[model samples]
Target chain A: MDTPIRVHGLTKVYGGGFRAVDALDLNVPRRSFMGFLGPNGAGKTTTIKIVTNMLSATSGRAYINGVSVMEDPKTALADVGAVVETPEFYPYLTPMETLHYLGELRGLSSCETTNRGRDLLDLVKLTDWREKRVGKFSKGMKQRLAIAQALLSQPSVIILDEPTSGLDPRGMVEVRDILKQLHKLDVTVLMSSHLLNEVQEICTDVSLINRGRLLRSGSVADLLDEVKARKIDVRTLRPLTPDMFDRLRAVPGVKGFAVTGDLSFSLDFEGEEDAQARLLIELQNLGLMVVSFKESGLALESLYMSLIMESR
Target chain B: MMEAASVVNNRERLPSDLQQMVTVAKYDVLKHLRSKRLLGLVILEALLLGLTFALPLLLGVDPTDDPAGYMSAFVSWVEILVIIGATMFAGDAIVSEFQSRTGYLLFPNPVKRSTIFVGKYLSTLGIIVLMLVVYYGVAAALVFAMTGGGTLLSLYSMLLACAYGAAAAALGFLISSVFKGSTGSLVLTFFTLFMILPMIAQLLPAGSIKPWFVLTFCGHVISYIMISPYPTDLVDSISLGNGEFMEYWTYYPDIGGSLAVMGGYVLICLALGMYLFRRKEMVS
Candidate 1:
């Protein structure tokens, strides 16, 4: 199958000798939600800009479904919908007007544009504010409108850069839910973001990039399985004394332990799941009244941090 | 995934380049219509037209006899309205796309940069023409009302005013493409066209070749078309105490010459502006 997005030796050097993107190579398979994980100033936005024809790559090339974006942008971008950096619209226009304009530009008929525009607006939850002028919209509303705009053409591939960047918690969840629906609808999504937890939740495949270079790329399951140790959180009915802490650290598979709260702490267990169970049993046998013992949510976070440190 | 595949296969046909250009132009016209800038220009034009009629009455100069002369004088002031309107519409049409990050949404589409540029230029031209129609429509009615006759020279002056407005818009687009900020482009276009060019035309030796090259020189045809027995090369002369005579040459550009200059500006500036816009990267 042809890859939805392919980049080879893509380098973008700005003025004053700043290499924002340096000889980067990446590929996103069809029908996959690929998380483009990176840090600030990591050239994620730059790479997206080049792919969407907003910026030109200094050397090498990028292609959408095997069409060279640099040589023929119109053809390359025909089936691609993108929301790069931030969402901005003509302040005078409403969401419906903006979508209709874009729909026409994308070659949809008037009836189809209206139908699809209304449907997309409903999907983004902007139906009530359809005719309201966008200039008065808050940033979160604009971002949602931008998402609706990106989906107007029913594009095969949707590329979003930090789609949930500036949203409040509820807004973030709302946008994430929309993206989840798109994922289910089989859109090939390549979303670049620094929010690792969001990526871990929404993405099936992952590519980690830093300083304009790709460090790792694989399935999230495979990456998670590669983690050598698991950090398991343990809660006790009462605050543990120093003697109890020493006794807890003496477990056979426990590599280290840190008290995170008065009655809770975490343990680094360098062992398999069965061994972890055995350790948990051992802790319970100590008669310390262990309330709960479960693995923490630091698996992906640790993997990302270690990879970013290794790349640096 | 199958649903998405089917949807992609069943997608509507895309537009051709010409269709896309027209779409962009139409939406841009809508944007201008919904904006206060167009209303502001209309109000300004009305005020200027009011001044044109009232100034003569206030000065006790009766133009009740020579309607052509009154029309010519009235249009001369209205020509400033055309300049202001063109500058406001076209001055930031291209630059604001970059400065305000509107290009983030616009440039990613299937349309070409040249199409966007041409679409914006055509929309700006249309608005300017609309403004001119209103201004001249009022002037023609007043002339007919006052003298019971309106000369063809008014029509001829209207054409020249349009050419001058097109040139000014072209110049504005050129300045807009060069600058990254809308305010800077707007201010510079106004100052260069209204203040600097006219000042240069005034400061240059009356008969120098430099004045002919300036856009404001071509703008004179709007007012010069009103003069009867149309003024010759040198309209007046003045003598200094040192026995040196300073001749003030009438920098009247004939119809063909004026069209050439204005058309040249339109073609060259538009081509250059489009080229720059196409090559410009959306780094911001």
Candidate 2:
């Protein structure tokens, strides 16, 4: 199969004896939207940097278009576009100048650069402010411009590191929509983000990492299946008293329970959906409370915590 | 995911490489040409030249009495222009990229770093040279109209002086590439070309240095016309009051020496500048 990106024995060490990334192996198929999920300080940025040819790898190889990043970085990165970490742009130039400049650098003809630059500006919804100097742009505006610049080459693969780290709700939704549109164009996207909900929303596949090591990598559905099924959060109007909480845990199908806060307690169910029904009845019969009951599918926050805690 | 089999099956090699390099160079030249600071510096030099040569002849000095004497005054005017203009022009040719944070935008392109160094440096030099030529033409016309003696010879001397100015500008450009800040480079260029070189000539024993040192080094190269009026007795004297400065001093450039000095300064400084530029991590 034609993989857009493949990593083998990838590792990185910083100056002060810190092994920022251990020997890690990864594969990303072409045209797939893959979420690179990792907590803070988990080497996500380092891996993206190495893959994009920004940082040299200590002892590994990342390949793009079958070209080795280590052996021939220029060609290996020829078809890859990336915005690793906070995007930086020349503040004095307008978006059009910045995009056209990059387009020319990538060998686009003047006509082609102008045409493509126009289209990319429209795509990022910055066509109106194309002439405004980037220095005066808001953070969201800059991020949009960065995305425009990244897509100017129409590369097969695009990597973004926490591309939505500091955006308002509207900005986040806008960026998410842009990612979806890019996916529809068949660009293989490898995005690193700590926001689990954002990842779960857009990624078809995911690779979870923590503490500089890979915890799991697979299709999101398959990886979620591998995670130990956990408690279901039932938010209700009244709190379940300490005694009622214990009795709910004693329900035959229920294995254990943990109260997240005052109104909700996560009750672990061992069996199938029928067991979930049984717990609901027992709680109703006890006249405790039942505002709402639903299965919270593998809350990545808890999953991340459990994985790290269990490994330690 | 696109089938890996299909990707491997459809891989094709394209036959366009030279086009890429030309595209990069074209855009870089365009961007360099649009720099207002560079253009502004060039215009400013042109105005100063007009004020120094045309205004003085029109308002104050007499060139008709002694055609060569007026040419001598023109030599001093050109010297100040060369010193000030070269210092300003060359000092920011490289440092401004860093200050503007546009260094990353230019350096990481498909073009080789050396292409950028030569392309931008040469273009700036060309602009500076054009300014000098314009001033030279205007001054020669004014001198011809007034004194009308040996006009061709006077113009020949002016061209020689401009050549020396080009060398000074090149040397100053090299210093700009070496230093991080434009102001520091400007001050350094002035000190090296104006104060330091002349100071050394005065401090060194007579005849200990070569004739080139006494005849054509530092500002003396451009100001040699003003010194030609000096008789032999005042040739060795330090004062310009009694000295009859020649419009042209016939000391051929120690080509090897000139190359050695300029090449050492240019290549070494440019190498370090490229190294620093390449090593920059390009943080915004």
Candidate 3:
């Protein structure tokens, strides 16, 4: 199957010799919600900008489907919906007007534009404020309206840059819920974000990057399983001593441990679940008051941190 | 609920470039209509019309005696008003797309940059034309009411005024394409058209260089065409006490010459502006 987005050796250098994106390569498969994970100033936005033809690539090339973005953007971008950075619309225009304008530009008939625009406005939950000027809207409202605009064309692939950034808790959840709905609908989504938990929840596949370079790209399940590590938290009824720490370290599967408190500590165990059970038994065998013991699920946060640290 | 799968599956035929251009122009016109600037320009036009009628009445000059002279007088103010409309509508059209980050929403659409530029230019010109129609319509009605008839010179003057407005709008778009900020482009457009070019025309010795090279020189034809026996390139001389004569030449751009200069400006500036706009990256 043809990739919805493909980049090879894509490099973008801003003025004053700053390489924002350096020889980056990426591929987003069709019908996959790929999380583009990166930190601040990690060239995620730059790469999206180039793909949208908002910025010219200094070297190399990017393509949407089979068309080159730089050489032929009009045709290449015809089937693409994008929200770069934050959402900004013409202040004087209402959400309805904004969507109609964009929809007509994308070649929908007036009737179709109206019907689809109404549907999109309702989908984004902006139907109540459809006629109100966008200037009075809060940032989250604008972001939601931006998503509505992006989906106006019914694009095959959607590229969003930090869709949930700068939102309040409720706003974040609202936007995440919309994204979840999009995922269930099987829309090909490539969203860039630094929120590890958000990606872990919404994305099926992820590409982790730092300093404008790709670190890892695969299914989330495979990546978490490949790390072969688990964080096991244990709590004791009473304060432990140095002797107990030595005895805990002597467990066969305990690769590392940190004493979070006098009566509590967490262990990094690299083993199967049966071995983990054995380690739990051994902890009790060491004559410690092991009040509670549980193994934390593998987290994308640790994998992201480890990969970023390794790359640096 | 709208089916996301159905919408994604049903793809309509994309409109041609010309159709898209018209769509863009229509929406841009809607933007202007909703903006206070259009209302402001209309109010300014009404004020100019008030002056046009009140000035002649205050001076106790019967326009019926010489309708062409009245038109010539009115054309001067009309030119100024048209130029103002041009600058306001076109001066920041392109630059604002970048400065305000509206391009982030706009540039990703399926339209070409050239299409966007042309659409904006046409819309700005449309507003200017609309303004001129009102201004000239008032002028024509006033002349016909006072004199019992209208002169063909008014028609020629209106045509010249429109040509001048289009040229000025083209110049504004060129400035907009060069500057990254709307305020700078707008200020510079007004300064170049009103102050700089007029200053050059005033400082240069007439007959030395044609002054025809300046946009303001072509602008004179809008009023000059209204003159009954249109002025020629005759230099006026006044006698000084010391027996030396100070020469004053009123440079008149004949109809053909004025058309050529305005046409040159419209063609060159629009071509250059579109080229620059096409090449410009939305860095902001």
> Could you tell me which residue pairs clash in candidate 3?
none
Candidates sorted on TM-score, descending: 1, 3, 2
* Model 1 lDDT tens row, B172-264: 999999999999999999888889988887877554554766788779888888888876565566887798987666556676777898999
lDDT of 2 at B101: 50
Residue-wise C-alpha lDDT for candidate 2, range B172-266, written one tens digit per residue: 76676666777888898888777776566565535444444321253353444344442231233344566753332233234335434444545
CAPRI-style docking class of model 2 based on DockQ? incorrect
lDDT of 1: 0.86
Best by lDDT: 1
Query: Which residues of candidate 1, in runs, are more than 4 Å off?
Result: B1-5, B9-12, B55-61, B235-237, B246-248
Predicted complexes: DockQ each: 0.61, 0.18, 0.54
Over A1-312, each residue of candidate 2 has an lDDT whose tens digit, in order, gives 368789888998877878877887889877778899887888888888777655567788888778887676556655666766656566657899887767765665568668778887887899999898787889888788777777776777778888898999999999888887775675788999998888888888888776667887878777666555655878877887877766776688777887877887777766666776877888888786788887775556566667767655
Candidates 1 and 3 compared: the better one by TM-score is 1
Taking all chains together, each candidate's TM-score versus the true structure is: 0.96, 0.75, 0.92
Ranking by lDDT: 1, 3, 2
**What lDDT tens digits, residue by residue, belong to model 1 across residues A1-312?**
458899999999998989999999999999899999999999999999999999988998998978899998888898888999886899999999999899889887779778878888888889999999899988888899999888888888899999999899999999999888876665788999999889989999999898999989989899999887789998988776787767777887888888899888888888887888888788777775789998876787788899889987
